[model samples]
Target: MDISKYIDYTLLSPTTTERNIIDLCHEAKKNKFYAVCVSSSYVALAKQLLEQTSIKVCSVIGFPLGSTATPSKVYEANQAISDGADEIDMVINLGFLKSKNYVSVLKDISDVKFAIGETPLKVIIEVSELNKNEIIKACEISLDAKVDYIKTSSGFSKGGATLTVVKIIKKTVKDSIKICASGGIDDIETVQKYIDIGVSRVCVSSDFNKKKQSI
Candidate 1:
């Protein structure tokens, strides 16, 4: 299905080094992937490495765990933009969402959105931690916050993106906001499934290149 353009080649490990970011950028350029997703610390280096390419540099804010304060997330988002990130992927506060504090949840996303202005923002809902109802409510809040995309997972959770959860997100958001499916996606076939179900982006690790080669 030629899913390269739909990919956000990601490297978000805590131990990720400069050499790792260098290789990630190299792989993204070689594969013609859509973007390179990295931690904020490496955004500048990735941007500099891919300066001559169209591949966007995406930075994650309050990643994996969305428990960071809203003001902190806003600052991180702004700092990432200033560091040359073309897109921002922020994790949503699962604690607030599950506690029925919809106002805090909504404000958390909205504050970052407002801070980033025109830069694209993708809210990671960490679907594995949420039930069907929570998933729907998360989508509703993301839509209310007017985010550019609602991502499936942070790849650090108990589980990653699932078709069932993606279905719920699709049904809720429809065409209003795009969907980015991340976590445990390692093959073209799986990537094809998400694309078939209307996922606009898929986040995969460097190992994806090995899988693509074997195919």
Candidate 2:
């Protein structure tokens, strides 16, 4: 299977530089990956570099930490879109979810979705931080918010995407929303495993970009 099309080539490290983004965009173009995922700050630069290419530009909001205020996430999402991001990936508020504040969790996601209009919004639940029940509840809330996708991780946490967690997310969400598995996804075989289980997209770092020749 040509997995390149299902990959969202990512570079979200804090120390990411302009030269790094240029290299990222170049790799995405050459490999024909589905998109290039970067921090909101580099959306415009990635957009400009990938101009005229089919590759989409995705920006992360609230990032590895989802504790940001709702309005702030909304503003960040809009700014990235205005800066030429094709998709938005926002982290869900883990604190609220743990506290069982479903209303606030739902509102946080819903507000961002409303702000972005039709632009695809993927809610990162940061699976590693939550238990089984928490994960399910988070998925349910994301569905209620009508998000486009439920991503597995932020890649900065204690752990990344796991098959068991993905399975739980899949069973909960069913076909209602797409799934994007990120963090520690460094091999093609592992990427194929997620795809086999119905994951729609996978966010891979630059290591996979250099390893694309094996695909």
Candidate 3:
């Protein structure tokens, strides 16, 4: 199904070096993947490397942990955009959501969305950290925040994306917001499962770094 087109071709580890990001951009461009997702700190470099290509550069905000203050996430996302990131994948404040501080959660996402100004905000709901109902609530809150996409995970947690959670998120977001199921996604077979279930994007992370090369 030409799954390469559906890949985000990511590298978001604490130890990701400059050379690694350069290599990642090269691979994404060569493979014709949809985008190259990297930490915001590397956004400028990835942008410079992929300036001549149509491949988008995605940057993460609030990263593996969503505990940071909303202003921090907003600034990070804004800076990433200024650095040439085409999309912002910001993690949701699970603490706020868990505490039923839905208002804070909504503002957290909305503020970032406002900061990015139409540069496609993908709210990482981190489905693995929430239950079925919480996942649904998070998706609904993301829709309210007017985010362009509701991503499943951060891939730095104990749990990762699952077909079950993807289905649940899809049912909630429907067509109002796009679904991006990330984490633990690698093989063509696994990726195809997400596509078949109507996921708009998948972060093909670890496997891509491993350079599986072929689906």
**Who wins the TM-score comparison?**
1
Model 3, CA-based lDDT? 0.88
TM-score of each: 0.99, 0.98, 0.96
Off by over 4 Å in 2: none
Instruction: Name model 3 segments beyond 4 Å from true.
Output: 209-215
| lDDT on C-alpha atoms for all candidate structures | 0.95, 0.94, 0.88
> What is candidate 1's lDDT per residue for 27-116, written digit by digit as tens?
899999999999999999999999889999999999879999999999999999999999999999999999999999999999999999
lDDT of 2 by residue, 48-117 (tens): 9998999999999998799999999999999999999999999999999999999999999999999999
Residue pairs clashing, model 1: none
User: How many collisions per candidate?
Assistant: 0, 0, 0
Higher-lDDT candidate of 2 and 3: 2
For candidate 3, lDDT tens digit of each residue in 99-146? Answer: 999999999999999888879999998887899889989988888888
Number of clashes in model 2?
0
What ordering of candidates by lDDT runs from best to worst?
Answer: 1, 2, 3
- Which is superior by TM-score, 1 or 3? 1
TM-score, candidate number 3: 0.96
